[model samples]
Target chain A: MENIIELKNLRKVYRIGEEKVIALDDVSLSIKKGEFCCLLGTSGSGKSTMLNLMAGLEKPTKGTIRIKGQAIEKMSEKKLAKFRQEHLGFVFQSYNLLPMLTALENVSMPLTFKGLSKSVRDKKARDMLKAVGLETHIKHKPSQMSGGQQQRVGIARAFVAMPEIVFADEPTGNLDSRTTKEVMGLITEMARENNQTLVIVTHDLEIAGYADRIVHILDGNIEKIDIINARRVSNEEADNIISGADAVPAGV
Target chain B: MNKRDIIRLAFKNFMRRKTRSILTILGVLIGTSAIVVMLSLGIGMNESFRRQLSSMGSLNVIDVNPWYFIEDGRGGGYSGQNVLDDKAVAKIAAIEGVEAVTPFLQTGLRLVSGKYVMYANIMGVDPNALEAFGYKTAKGRMLTEDDTTALLFGSNTPYDFYNPRARNNYGGGYVYFGGYMGDGVERPEPDVDVLNDKLVLTFDFSYGERRPGGTGGSEGGNKKPKLYKVKGVGILEESQDERAYSIFMNIEYLKKIMKENERAQGSMGPRPGGSQQEGYSQVKVKVTDMNNVQKVQDQIKEMGYGAYSLTDVLKSMQETSATMQAVLGGIGAISLFVAAIGITNTMVMSIYERTREIGVMKVLGCMLGDIRNLFLIEAAIIGFFGGLLGLGFSYGASALLNRFAGGLFGGGYYYGPSQDSIVSLIPAWLALLALGFATLVGIISGFMPARRAMKLSALEAIKTE
Candidate 1:
């Protein structure tokens, strides 16, 4: 399998008055194509910062980021925008969809910048909405939709352009347990169907369990990489483990 | 972005803010209409003056009169020979821009018809010298060589001259004295048809002989019973003096009458040495071109003559029109300035409201140029519609003014390039120019706001909640 994203000795630092706070320290990681990987960390463990750097939404203090073997950090602002649009998709925990746009319109936005005709974009966005079971609610604005439904629309938006990698930061953070299961299941199924590499950042162990590989971060460093394969745990078992259950199988 | 899309978006945006757009347009309309109305009035005034002056005489015609310079010691009595003669008339006609020249012979005479007698001035003219004298016959016809007995009367001819049967009380009832000849002879029993009929002249050389000069006052005087048949009455269309009435007759007839008088007195030895009429009393010259009237007048003045032309009237009219235009335009400009300020206020408010939208557009890949173009297009649309409305208002206003004030102002009050009315006219070019100027003002007013919108940082704009 080819590597879709690679980070080399990534470091990010912030200054607080007279003291320096390190957001990420000497972090190195790699994710293969079509892999559903999740960075699991508590608060202040540099999980969100890692996702932001990988998405090229912010410049890193020091480090190199390569997506599909092209250096993203070296690109100009204009070129970086194009690169972000073409190679990556983002789903935020708050479901940051544009308020002025309808569900379908929000999903079609990334494609609009791609120079597609209105008809073509509409058709593609509709197809994505149907895939997420949002065909009946395509015309509803984000404010009109429920939290779970809004996340579904966000999922549709992220995958509509068929980008190589999708970065989802706490995809189920704002949802109840049932809605969390629905949104997580939809995201996992869509990523697998499209053979896309999905990188999710979350503090919730149950959300992280949905990924094919879970990387645990402690004190701004990767502490463990657990691959769940063959004998995968059921969602209920993952929930139990996240709720601090005592025992679980090694692969599960 | 493509132009069509930009225009479509601009139109849509304009439609969204209908009230603001209309108010801006109204401002432009008032400015444009005021300019059109004011300029038309200026033009109309000029045209009215021109028509008034033209009716008085040929606007192109110049009048030249003889001027004599007497020696310092010479008393003013006929000190100089008549400078305007046939030779001088011919010379003036040969000048580069001279069109025609005519010499006039004028004298007052009394016509006696039976017991009815009336007095009038007579003008002796060569039939071929009409244009040079700027003569126009308003009634009857001008004299021709074959009609030797023809008499052209002026408009002011006494009523009895045309109606012979009409009663006359000039001398209390009726009294006859016959027509007076230059020599003071009165023939009794004169032809009664001479009131409105032709007279036949008879001359007998041996009828009257010169007596020896003595204190008995018997010096010989010429006498002739020459008659003239009233062929026609002519009305002079133009004259410098309204009260100085005159009539025209063939020069040949006058010469023949003089000769008969000489022969009747038995004083006809050898004919006078010079041509019958030695020189003209006054010569009037017409120039070939109206524009050259002044130049010709100047040349005549240099030749020691008094000259007058309508160019002075036209010049005064031009000056008045220019002054009127400036005053009127200044008034219109004040309104235009207010309209521009209105546009500025509207654009500034629009910029304030659309700041966040502008930022979103920038983030959506709209170039800085595109953002500026969007705002300018909106401003231009406002200016264009305003100008159109202004023109419409001006048209309505001018029409109402003409209808209500036309009579009070008089004819030619509303003079257009091709027609006359009470309301002034707005020409097509001026209307077009007004629209363009309004649009330019809008663009200028929108420029700073558009630049401010463009300079906004996208990140900052997006972060504005």
Candidate 2:
């Protein structure tokens, strides 16, 4: 209903040995509050780049990108770090859980960055993992867990802090079709329960089936945008919903 | 993240590579022990010098001797008057920093018992000043003002007595001057028990001289030469001091004996002045503090006496020991420098390996300063533990050195055979300072590596394998 993330004329250019390559063409986009959106593109079409830019992980060459009406691109590194900690979470394509940490530790990492006490962050992370059906695997390290389980931990980490936005890039790119549907369902369900904005970047058409809107990007430019009501379109999808996700409280 | 969490994460990362961490810590250990032991040697030398010099004579005591008819060795090119007599002793006593002043008077006398006679220095001194002069008896009480008839024998004073007839027959190689026979012959034991024997002192220098084969009698031997009955009140411990091979008595009593003996002879004395008019042989000034010894000596010298103290020798000895310590410390510093380089190298290698981990931490909103603090704390912990262990090693080394390292330098590093000789000393301050310095070295060594970690671009670091 309300615009939580706004991008006006976003452009990103990279210099490769004497050639100027445009990684992201002039693109104007806005993500709404509580919307589960998908940025769909081929390998070189800048979907991951878009995710990175929105998460404040990379500086854009030209654009005014604002989150909650504050210009993120213009902020200094120190301020951006604090801003990201308080407002954003990230899930990478490879799951990117620190291999040395257990699943519970990985899930609690976002709350840890927010400087919560260990016990407090741990409790929230445990509840988030239970919501994703990984309660029994809390102490399992990333190397010991399956792809689906690690993505569940990743999803738990991204939402445990109850941030205003979550940027997930190819979150299911390394999982199988069965695991892909399960992870995507867990991620969108958790986001929908909290009414938090979720932005996912992927090349798979099936992954877009769970999104409220699908944005198609071709050659660093948005080709089209499709709005869908997946909840209303499929009653069977509701059965596959994460068991305890809808009970997630919307905390201030 | 909180400070504690950042530090905990850094420590966990350090523990990831156990062997590398241990090796780095070992380097710091060797470096710390090296410096501590090297510095302790200089401190040991200084302490040893103090003990040795003090045993010979109190370092704070100055000797002021009269430059009499014999010119002082100072070679002033123009002779000055010897003013360090009884009057000058009072002047010196009034000088600032002089704790006490005592005059020393020595005259030759013959000690006799039955058939044994010995020529000994009859040292006369004020009984009150004996304690200040550090003179203590090993067997009996020291001479006092009322003990005018008493005498204190030096430990070796009995050795000066011998039969001149037996010595002339012996072939005079070892000088059997202690009433002894030649080789393979039983020497004559002291015929007098000094404490209980009838001790007599005669001021006549030739009292023991006898004609070679003439019935063992000198010119005045038949008359007994007015024997003065004295009591042996004390026997002093043997020392490398002016009192060695001498006998002590009250100064006024010795002067009275000499004056009365000359009156009985009624002959012309050797010098212009009578024995009663003779001045003190030397003056001793005790100082309150060792640091003030040189000052007191200088003032005494300006007053025109040949003055000296142990500080003159101590100053040169300390200088030599300081140079020796510097060279040794330099050698130790080179080792520590190598260790510092090892720390930097280890940190650099750690950074290269943990690039992705650091990137993950940064992306998770850990502050750049926190990342820097983490690495520094890790390096410093290594230094702290190494320093603590190194100090333990140095203490062990010091104990072993003092116990078994004695007698290496002509009996001992001490002046005499002393049990408290120290070859290496690590004072408390040195140990504490070494610990702090080692930690500082670790922090400084980690500085550049930490900066590199802080400057790493999060985006590129995460993209690294």
| Model 1 clashes, total count | 11
Native contact fraction per model: 0.02, 0.39
User: On residues B1-465, what C-alpha lDDT tens digit does candidate 2 reach at each position?
Assistant: 787777777777778788998898888889898999999988898888887787778888888776523345776455455744677888999989888888877778878766667776888788888888788888788988798989988765655665555645223222544333124585454445677778778865555556655544346344445779888888887576667668989988987887777777766463222253556657788998889999988888777778878899999989999998899888888888888998899999999988877787777777788888889987787777778888899899988877888656323543344667778999999999999988998899999999999888878766623
Ten contiguous residues with the weakest lDDT in model 2 chain B: B173-182
lDDT of 1 by residue, B1-465 (tens): 446445555676677668997888888888878887887777656666677666556676776666544445655533334466667777778878887776665544445443344444566667776645456776556666565656665544433232233443343222322222123454343233332454222233221222345322133454434444354545555343321256667766756665565565555552332224555555667787878888887777667666677778888878978898899988998898898888888887877776666654554445567667778887787788888788788778777766676555535422322234334666677778888888887888778877777677654554413
Query: Could you give candidate 1's per-residue lDDT for residues A1-252 as a string of tens digits?
Result: 667888989988878999999989888887888888899999889887788778665577888999899887787656655776687776767676766568988788677656567788999999999999999998898889999999999899889889888888788888999999999999999888888989999999988878777888987788877767312322333445545544554464
Q: What level of docking quality does candidate 1 show?
A: incorrect
State which candidate has the highest TM-score.
Answer: 2
In model 1, the runs with Cα more than 4 Å from the true position are A1-252, B2-4, B65-306, B407-423
